[model samples]
Target: MWEAPEAPPRLTVSALTAQIRRQLEGEFREVIVEGELSNFVAHTSGHWYFTLKDAQSQIRCACWKGTNYRIRFRPRNGQQVVCRGKVTVYAPKGEYQLTVEAMAPVGVGEQQLAFEQLKAKLAAEGLLAPERKRPLPLVPRRIGIVTSPTGAAIQDILNVLRRRNDGVSVLLYPAQVEGAEAAASVAAGIRWFSENPDPDFPVDVLIVGRGGGSAEALWAFNTEEVARAIADSTIPVISAVGHEIDFTIADFVADLRAPTPSAAAEMVTARRADLLAEVGSMASALTKVMHIRLLRERQALETLARHPVFDDTQARLRDALQTCDELTLAVQSAVQNRLRFAGWRLERAGNRLRHYPWRPYLQLHEQRVSELTAKLIAGVQAQAAVAQHRLAQALTRLNTLSPLRVLARGYALVQHPDGRLIRTTEDAVPGQDIVIRLSDGRLLGRVAQVLPEPEAKPDPPPHS
Candidate 1:
């Protein structure tokens, strides 16, 4: 024999799958596939399975949970996206597909596209309606802030608040301001204020914002989730993301929007602050109003005072004063004439008295006084005797029923310290203080004994 029998080389399914996997992997190590997404299925395991198809051709693509979950913008069905990932053949299926390391929408700037898409979606749901907006509190009692704990946003807000002497309570809910998790974190902060509201530090308004940054840095605010959170907040929300020139989807859904984080603080307190700052102007305005009102009221009163009715009443009062003056003069003349006539009569009477009435009248008056005095003595004696008889009779009747009379007849009244009369021995308690009232005075004594009444001897067994 010249050579050993040659063995046939037949490849197994595993070997063929392996060869295809290596060959496809080498050919498309790093790939950028641009196509419209279709049949997208986000598996429960967080893996995204979809078809990248165009008008002419189509290819299968898979975004692993590990790689694709990092993408910020959500990939939708029929959305034109550029997927960048390594092309690898799935060993089991022997099909080649993009791994989808990253993805972005086509035609528009990536950030702008995401922003517009979310804006439209939210607008359709009425989250962007003016009716959904809430007015800033006239005087916010508490203001909740959602931003990075150490970021410049919080510092700016605090500085502004300090400058204005913002009396409203501030509660800072620290969350990442710029990152993949920033949107969810911001949403969580809104929900925290909306749900776990503290009665002591109750959040009346929310300021969700960050300092100025690039569009990508503030992209978290454009997220649909964060927008929905702002829309659904029970408390009024103020969106203050980026600078004045930059706008986000959050600004559309929030109850209010500020150009910057510091501006948000000023806005929350602006109603009260503006009024306080222009206190002089307001005072002037009020003074003007009061002056106008006073002028109007004064004119009305002056018009009333000038009425002919009042003038007629005043004329009548003047007439009364004139009549009173005339009467006064007439009374004075009449009094003077009466005094002169009385003086003449008194002079005539005095002359008569000097000539008449001497010792006879005095003697007669003295005799009459003596007679009346004797009569008065007799009447006084009779009244005294009648009063004395009635008094004796009243005393006799009172003595019969009086407790003092009973006590004087050798009876004693026992009374408890509380002033209750003790009727029997059972009413007395040993060692308790009591009072015994005799005829003259009350004697305080300690109760020595309380003897119980003896029981009858069973009534002699009461007849069988």
Candidate 2:
């Protein structure tokens, strides 16, 4: 009801805009806006002023140096983008503007497309082949870097290398990291470092890349010439381009790929703590090997020391000497016994010689001679007597048993012509010449006068 009274025609242009500015400043403490970028202008004062518009409307935006520094890439016209900022009204112009805190590109990213194209081309050329890659040097004496002289990438690499290993030297081959000739310049730097070897430029490995940038800003790394040069380089290369998510042709052709420049530096050198640990391990292993060898040798020596030849050589010699002594004593004793036996035999022989009597020998000899002479004479006389007696007795027996006696006793002995006495008539043959022996003499006879003696009977037994 009070609004009815025509409030003296409200405020003028300036006053109305000031009221709108106040209202807008309160309403948009923070906001999110999406549109296509246009009229992008970056001032020397480090401020980015641009316009965001669509088919329907447009809004002015500004990013001061402090906030603009956070942007990863430069904003270009025709790029669809999203921004987070606060909407505020300028009281002077009576206009609303956005103070952008952060901004990002919308839709399919442009940098991603460029990265894919470069990667695909390099892969087709066999630059990305696993076989083309070489192993990183185990201990790089010198490391080369190809990057913008003032870029943070070089600083990052230097920092890592210095911190990791102070012994390794770094050679910087400065070149533009962005711009038209950056690719060629970078590729030339790589070739120069590889071909030129001096005490100062004796690079064992090369790190070629820069800090993260948008696709357009990183285009130099995507060139075919750069990839070819990297693939052809004799020095082993490590490609560290952009952030972890970014890829480029140089990365594909390098012998090894690192996600960032810092990582590439780390690969070239070893941490001091890690190297010390490795040295300790090797020393321990060597010590163990030496210990094993020493133990084996000691055992062999002990075994030799315990051998019979080494431990008991003196005892063996002594035993042999004792045996020889015993043998010598036995021989000496045997000789003494033999000498005693011989001396005893000689003494006995001498005693016998001394006791033997010549007189007895002579007496025995004379007695034996006399006895032999007597026995010889007696034997001869006895034999003569016995012979004479035997002859006389034989003469008597002969006379008694002689056939002449028989003949003289009125018996006749008929003898064959051969002078054989015939005892029976059968011994005589008829008409054989014979001799009849008589006591007086023998008479010649002839068997023609046959006279048969009468059969005589056997003698009768004697009567009592």
Candidate 3:
């Protein structure tokens, strides 16, 4: 065939633009592009428009508010990110763009962004207030640990606690400390320990979190639910989330932040050797203080012994002799006065004794007392006899009123087998077992038969 001029493809301007747009959209759909964000603009109409670029190439991207809201952190122009989105074209301008569905910071990952977001939020809510923090118990009776049962974190904490203070008991609330369900499981464990505290196994402090890991591995602690659970916990929570340098949301919300699990255990325990050393130091200081006080007291006694009055022995003896002489003279004067008064008293007593008739009076009083005593004894004996008779009568009446006496009089008490009193025939079913109690014995019986009394017939009415 002869070479012919190529026919120009014929299309209207609108159709051409549409065709190009369809081609671009088909080629760029569902792409994951890695680049630094730039020219970022979040519109009032709830759409994000940005440009993603590396050193070599650039592409326009758009994320609707619905998807943007799901992202954990703000997307800034300088942030390097990997975005997953579908390509679409602005038909009017025929410009190709990406409709981003999800995005994450390239090096930091979504988990890290989530952690920072949660940390910031809880910090703003004052969950991490310094005043809200509680001191770790000096010696926790039981420490509750929430972590992976098989993890090194638990082992490390156990080792530290055991070495520091073996007296404290550790109660494990084994939970997944990483992965998708970690937050919920940790919160559940905290709640369980709180609600069902054991009497003998009560937990005084809670140690929560795992060993050091990547941001994704430690994301469970970043969850708001986990943070709030730690904040709301009644028992003090010591957050041991990661290595010494790592920090998580739980660390801020917790009552105390431990750099590592081992450190948290140390915070809760006291070393035996350290305590003994402190005691020894205090004892030594106390002994020194006592020795100094005793020495000072002895010196004061010696100083008093060396005083002028104690040193002048002969003068002191002479003063004592003079005082004795004065006391003897005073004693003699007092004795002479007392003797004179006694003589006068004895004379008066003798005259009174001679003038009185005490013997006759004493005989008369003795006779009266003897007569009254006889009357009192007779009255008391008579009253006692009357009381005894009344008491005998009361005893007889009480005996007559006794239930045992009624049973002895041939009256039996009927009761259901269950011990309820059976007062009427209706109380016993035809085949029901019953107990009959007599004065000295009980009989268990079953109803063999029941017969009702015949109804009385009414007399015939008078003849009308």
Candidate 4:
């Protein structure tokens, strides 16, 4: 009776869609699908909508920006990619799609392709230029390390330093060397050393790296941010990631590349003992050179001393002494002859003096002196009289031509107070003080007139 009354079961579109969505989402939770990408459209909402198909069929695919951003290379329309995701049914569109969580180029792995792509981009930009790389410090006073504190990298670096007895102090900047945040953490560590360097404990070179790991695990260093951080580092960066064969973008941009963490430590630290040994070697070489130089110089001087010139010195001395004796004898003989001739002249003079008469000569000289004295006295009086006559004539002539003499004859000379002679009335300004000079003295007065002299006319030419 109740079974007879049961009506046909009804299913709403929403309920049917919900059931399908749950089944698809649960069954296809994780899958790997290799297909060719087509109809690739990126929405403004940062969600990629595309269709992935092979020979048999095609299906819709979607990759959000958050997932796509982790992809190393941009996916193209015809690219063959192996995508990993879940199959989910969209309720609104009533469609089934692959929600891509990870994608990789089919031929080359994602990490390798991404590394190559980034390397080419950075190389083109000159960030990987050989000239941009810096030389390591000869003796780094302080060394900064950016790696996991508990990793083998730090232990390796420390062991090398301790073994070498390098005096460089260590500054550890702990950072995650792997995982999702590895790139940001590594970049932040590099930036901290570059931006917040302590002057008192200055760091010379920075070692940024980690121990060996798989390519997937070491992908952080291959990131652009890590490479840029290395490139922009102020201190010299030694990239010591993985092993000698494993290289990353950071290795290209770093100032130097170390094969391993131990090598990186060696690069930034130099043992004092090694430096001292080198210096000692140089000093020994210098001492040897100087000794050789002095020996050569002494030999040269000895050779000069034993020459023939020095050997004949005693003979030269004897010859010089003999010549000096002969010169002395000749000088003595000359002096004796000079003395005899002088003695003969003195004898002749003495004989002549004795023969001359004294009293008669004195009387004659006295008489001559008296006559000459009288004549001299008369000549002196005549010369004096002539000089006096000449003086009187000179004074008379001078007085006749003198302006002062004219002034004495009742004429006055006009002059300015400044001692300028007033040749015309124009020489003095009206109401200005003027000077009048008498024969004996000057006088000052005020000017009352300044009349200019009339220009003189040329005289008529004389009749021919």
Error of 3 at 98 (Å): 23
Q: State the lDDT of candidate 2 residue by residue for 116-202, as single tens digits.
A: 677887777776899988987655656788999999999999888767665466788988889989888988988888778885336
* Residue 163, model 2, lDDT: 76
Model 4: lDDT equals: 0.74
When summed lDDT is taken over every stretch of 10 residues in candidate 4, the lowest stretch is 349-358
Instruction: Estimate every model's Cα lDDT from 0 to 1.
Output: 0.73, 0.72, 0.73, 0.74
lDDT of 2 at 292: 58
Which has the higher TM-score value, candidate number 2 or candidate number 3? 3
Residues 354-381 of candidate 1 have per-residue lDDT tens digits of 3333235434534553454344334334
Residue 83 error, candidate 2, Å: 12
Maximum-lDDT candidate:
4
Q: Considering summed lDDT, which 10 consecutive residues are worst modelled in model 1?
A: 304-313
Error of 3 at 397 (Å): 95
Off by over 4 Å in 4: 1-106, 270-278, 309-464
